[model samples]
Structures are given as structure tokens and as C-alpha cells.
Target: MDVRVTDDADVAGAADETRSLLAWLTQEDELRGRVTPQERPPVPGTLGPVLDGLVVALGSGGAVTGLTTAVVAWIRSRHSDVTVKATRSDGASLEISTKLVGPMTPQELRAFVTDSSRLLEGGQGGQGGPGPDGGAL
Candidate 1:
């Protein structure tokens, strides 16, 4: 998932919104819950190097403010089997990038959440590419 925090001026608010969003996601049957950060090699390491993903923006109240172009780039690099893009809301003037990573199951979403959690706990966020076996996914 590519999440962006457009309003950096209010980092605390953004975090709050992130927490609320995560909570809401957990309650939803469709979305995979919160991202569980995993422990992997750091971004500087060679084995399973961490990839620089999109930056999610949090509003003053911790709500998702907006997304950026980086989100689109990250989605494209991570999920090659799918197509991703973003659009702006004319009324709200909010820019959001949506990436289609095929389809995400509840279980997969949970796994992603776990992986995200691990990343937050200092683990490598996303894999740069394929491994020795040429496994990208």
C-alpha cells in the first residue's frame, strides 16, 4: 500500500490520523489491518536491501492529508505485475495516487501490516527487487 502524508507541518496530527486509519482498517473486512513492521537488512545492506518507499502524510489531527508522486513510483517498483496511478480531487484539492497490486486478500493485507510493523520496528521496509532466484514477488 502506498500512503502519503502531504502536510508535514503537522507530523503529530498525521500520526494520529495514521493511527485512526489503522484502527479503522482493522475493523474493516476488506482492508488488511495495520502494517506490521518486520526486521530485515537495513537500506544500506546488500542482502535483502530495503527499498525507499512512498512517504505518507499525516494531517494536524493525524488524518491522511495527501499523497505525492513518490507513492506512484514506489508502487510501480514494488509491484510490477500490476498498474498504479493517482488522481486529484477537484473539490477537496487532494492528490491521491492509487496503485493496483492486482488484488489484496484480507490475509495478505494482514501479512502486509505485519511486514509494515516490522519495518517500523527497524526492519527493512520493502525489498529492492528479486533475490538470487530472480523472485521479485
Candidate 2:
């Protein structure tokens, strides 16, 4: 999964917050070395390589579910309006915005996590259920 954080409210804060999210993800017991930032070549006059998004390797044993939960937790802890989008290798993606999720209750938050995990896992909200918000992931 490749995770990207976008913050239209503060361009400068996006990178900082993205790094913070990366740090938080890496700290998870199920993630550790499984997370790495995406590297891009610098433009003509840039000083160093560009770092954007994150490539997280999720395998068996509920790692994907754990990742979704951690991501929601990170978004809930943020003070800025940032949206995190995670794309799977198969091109399926899920976007979670801090602004949208901020007002959700604990149960709603858990459902959000569960729905995200299901969508990302190609289950589309688990069982024969509908996708979260009736939208494609």
C-alpha cells in the first residue's frame, strides 16, 4: 500500500505531518520495517531527492486491518485538515480525511477503520455488504 497525505490548507505542514504519520506507522508492532517512504528524483536544481507518500508492505495475519486502524488513529490525533490516501498494488485506493473523521464517535471510528480495511483488502466492506459510503475504494 502506498500512503499519501494531502493538505490543501497548509502546503508546508503537509510534509511535516506526513513524516509524523510515517513515524507513527513505523512504530506500530505490526509495521516496523514494513513501511518506507516513496523516493523520487529531484528536479533540475533541487538539493536532494524528493520524498512523498509511503509504501507499506502488508502481508498476512491482519496487517492490513492493523494498518487501517493505525492510520485512523493518526488522523484523529492531527490538528490540521489533512487527507490520507492509500493505494493498493492492484490500484484500489481509500481516502480518509481528518476533517471528515474528526467529528465521528468511537463506534463510528471503529466502523470507519473496519470499512477501510475491508475495502483495501478487496472485500468492499466485508461479507456481501456495500462499500463505505457507497463509493469505490
Judged by lDDT, which candidate is best? 2
Q: Cα RMSD for candidate 1?
A: 16.9
- Candidate 2 residue spans exceeding 4 A from truth: 1-10, 125-137
Write down the lDDT of every candidate, Cα atoms only. 0.30, 0.69
CA error at residue 110 for candidate 2, angstroms: 1.1
Question: Which sections of candidate 1 miss by over 4 Å?
Answer: 1-4, 7-97, 100-102, 125-137
TM-scores of all candidate predictions against the true structure: 0.25, 0.82
Quote the lDDT for 136 in model 1. 28
RMSD of each: 16.9, 4.0
Alpha carbon lDDT at 95, candidate 1: 23
lDDT of 2 by residue, 1-137 (tens): 44343333365565577678889988999888888787668768977765666888887667888888888888888876777777776656677777667887777677777777777777753222223354333
Q: Locate the minimum summed-lDDT window of 10 residues in model 2.
A: 125-134
lDDT for position 85 in model 1: 18
Best by TM-score: 2
lDDT tens digits by residue: candidate 1, 1-137? 33422312133353333343334333433323322222325546345633222233222221221122223233333322322211122111222122322244545434443433333222343423212232223
